[model samples]
Target: MYGFRFEDVIVDDDAAADDLQAHLADAHGGKARPLCMCTPAGVPMYVAKVGEHYVIKRMPNTGGTHAPDCASYEPPAELSGLGEVKGEAIQENIEDGVTTLRLDFSLSKTGARIAPAPSGEAADTVRTDGAKLTLRGTLHYLWEEAGLNRWYPAMAGTRSWYVVRKFLLQAAAGKVSKGEPLGRSLYVPESYSQDNAAGITQRRIAHMAALAASGKTRKLMIAIGEVKEIAESRYGFKIVAKHLPDFPFMLSEELHLRLQKRFENELALWDSIEDSHLTFISTFGVGPTGIASIETLAVMVVSVNWIPFEHAYDKLMLDALTVQKRRFVKGLRYNLAENKPLACAVLADVLPKPVALYVQPPGIEQEDEDALSKLIGESDIPSWIWRAGEAMPELPLPSHDSASPGSSLHRRVPPRLSAPMLLAQKEGPESAW
Candidate 1:
């Protein structure tokens, strides 16, 4: 278990759980800062009060300093799109335990007749000044803060809509965006139950009361939910989320086409994988007629365990990792373009050091391949590379000191092509989208 130093007290994670509240409370009151003793040089940490509980959070820019096996360890920001807007768009105030975000999109509409500007999925293709968070960047931030980007064998089959909503809400607790608390503007559909349908509806109505308030400017709420389906409506396309069957967000024909064009890769990936989920983060407002219309939105495809993957190859690699019970952190592309190289994942259970996993797409340009190689060479952590259209390489072996050689952790077999991969290959390199 990981150990932490709280002033003169030293405690392991398991033992600290019993008295964590007391220590965190004291830490919040200007007591000595807690240090994670994962390495010879301890990593500084701060106490953040998340709702009713106080938790230890690694200090800003200190994630790479922790040991690979430590829960707080994170691959360097440069390995992901997060490197672009870490301190600029998303500013963390360590003294106050609040993160202030600057958003490129507006939270409220001024004129009733004026339509919102066109916005697309912002996933890999969009480029910005790094001064504000795009819709997809915001989603990535929330997912990362909620700990959904990290996976372990113990997490299998334990994640559900209820858990996702809880963690997302908790992540937004102390976050401030555009001078308003993010929790007030964020809506995550609660898990549905026949026993509490009426109560759920009532609470949802109360929560969205601001959107229907009397004013020239209509307030907008950011909703994050799994897409159940996108069907034709009388006026346009309607998105039906998994939990909220009663609430369908409307999409105009123009926006629908734009969504299809901009996020063709994400949509294609979601369509190709039967068990995968397409998650949407959208800015929507409730009209006077009780209709919810989406203004701007972004989409992402996540695996069965809710870990985001970029393509079919990524999914195949993740499947192998999960099947082998390897612990790893899935990398995310916040605002990075598709051409840029980023680690697909970082293996945490490997011996000697963690390994950064890279999947080179087929027909990649020579310069891009060189850039990817340079990225891998620059990183202190080792890397495992897999080129598309070829057999996958064997995964790095996990530490035998941590687990028996006969255990699942010792199985470092290469991944076989799944149905999705076979389909992608059959359709050619372009179909890997």
Candidate 2:
């Protein structure tokens, strides 16, 4: 609720083994090899940055095509590699008072060609990476492990949904374990998570699944208060572990089911509403409807399908994904200032180009009231409420018709530029209209 502290570790896309191991050693405190598995039995596995291409070795007729479908994957600019990755520890990447971790993940060389079925197999067997990839733009996920439910109570509502989804992903990946999971996060929003942008959010989820399916990024971020730093290196890394507590695991299947059901129900409720809603109040006789309510007939403005969507998801991407219920107001109604940065960001993320919005609230300042009232033809009226019975505007009337031609009451003399108009000449008077 205060603020989040993250110490980022940047991994270059083209980084090799020495580059990665050196950083890991600093983070892992010269562990030579840090533990990379759920149960730390040995030093961590070495994630050697191998060459870009992959070759399938046919161990004597044990294989067929090099690739039944696609060949080597060329990673996009986003996840070709990382700037730096720690050895499954938070303190290794600490900066200031907080800590952070990041990595450039790529589609690993795990896929191999699908060989022909043995001579006379019943069905045409298929062979491909069990995970199916989709063409979505961006995706954001809120996930956690079944074990960590003890630490993060807010996940009680949606634990079942994730557990089930996690189970299915693990089964497909042909691996499942406690403590470790396919997708998870240290900070999961308390309420439902949403992804307004279709492609990006989905792609992000897919990318994470790719890691989980291929057995990578298998690390967890420990809670700060729950754990303590035991040691630190000269290069500012801390050796840490959980400060043991008497309480142990008691996460129930019933609770998990309840949470999953509640999450799904909430998601169904959200599906009922669009991204926007509009409420307008008819004031004075200005609206299309002739009858105006004294309290101003409320006009509800809604952002429906008609509202243009952005190529990338809007702020809604961050908003929709939550683990628990929260008191979040919809739209920017609470924003008092005239300038709308939040609205601007949301619109820019959705709209192709920039859009502008202006809001006019009730009330007028004393200084500009006179000028404003003059423009509205109510110069004589004084006060805030300009009802129908107020006084009308004042206009000058003509004075004695042509009695004193020199003195024009209706038309004031202009400031001199050319020679002034002569009303009447001494000998022969000429009247100018």
Candidate 3:
């Protein structure tokens, strides 16, 4: 249902690829009359030159125009950190197909710090303001922008590590981190396939060799990979990533113990899932023996759908909505810690506006209630609260049958919540849920 339009000429969806290319080139190169592409409904798009070929990309601030089934379809921006930093932190230069990002945090730190790097979850507490994206938030932004988080039924079992690496490399291009191009300091191994297995291994060895030779005075590099396991070893703990099965990154016993303690809640959440993966984003250095070890690392738990979740409550909520064939966007913690007043999820597709769902942590204290009330009041859109004390309430059903271009669901205005939502108390013992 999407087609290209240029200079008042519309190309049918079935138009030849050559024909589309011709029109894209013909529509004024730099300025004046820009070649425009759009969904059948006329949502504007732009032609982007990626490497050697021109590809159609959704126009900045126009992702909501595409139908949900379309590849360009993105959930409402209000749901994610993307909304928080659209103009200030993230700036797009559509003319060149590059996005410039201003990060508040430094990727590489100078001098030595007393403590090892904090776990991803622990880093949230260190945020100074909600507007700026933390280092972990920046990584989540890259993943989402790369379209890795988007999924369709047909893609099942078709996604491999090779595809992931390609997408990530593409996303890292033109991105700036701490005054350096992100690609310069980032290392993601090429996926190993049968024919290229040996070649891939050799390339990986060379890259690791370079990292190993990087002296202590050199800045630490960033590495992002799926965590396969953390097993105890003589030196400390070996971190095996799914993409680099043969190579395990080393973590010192002290650092490994600190990571475990810092992210115990996150680890427990990931372990509870049957179909989930733990993604580790860390600053690492290679040892003289070619063994790599983490300097500081952050961890995120991704669901079967590929969207990230913070807590077990979020996992349960998203799983329920996913089962009902509903579309929604997962909320990012950004700089806000888990204990903060944040929407757990934003239900998309049906609404006056997308509904913000806040899951109250069990056994809320007085200050927590105050924080929740303040958050609820500050939200610009409609919201709903699900408390831990009650039996899980029926989620607001999306009005799919009645939903048309502009139709909205029954909006449940969040109440002026004062008392803490009770947590389900076990009769005898007090335990963390």
lDDT of 1: 0.79
Model 1: residues >4 Å from true position, as ranges?
13-18, 112-127, 402-433
Candidate 3: TM-score?
A: 0.77
Candidate 1 structure quality by residue, lDDT tens digits, 1-433: 3466778887654554448678778888875798887676688888877677776777889888877666677788888988888999999998878899988888898775544434434442365767788888899989988778887675667777666776677678789987899999998988887777787888888888899986878899999999999899998999999989998999899888888888888899999899999999999999888888998888999998889998888899899999998888889988777778999999988755889999887888999999998998888889889998799899999787445554323332111101011111112111000
TM for every model, in the order presented, reads 0.89, 0.15, 0.77
Instruction: Kindly give the stretch of ten consecutive residues in candidate 3 with the minimal lDDT sum.
Output: 414-423
Candidate 3's displacement at residue 204, Å, is 2.1
- What lDDT does the true structure give each of the candidates? 0.79, 0.21, 0.62
Off by over 4 Å in 3: 11-14, 25-41, 58-78, 103-116, 119-124, 130-133, 150-163, 192-195, 206-216, 351-353, 366-381, 396-433
The candidate scoring highest on lDDT is 1
Residue 361, model 2: Cα distance from true site in angstroms? 49
How would you order the candidates by TM-score, starting with the best?
1, 3, 2
User: Least lDDT summed over 10 consecutive residues: which range in candidate 1?
Assistant: 414-423
Predicted candidate 1, C-alpha RMSD: 8.3
Model 3, 263-305: lDDT tens digits are: 7876887788888888777777665676676777777888875
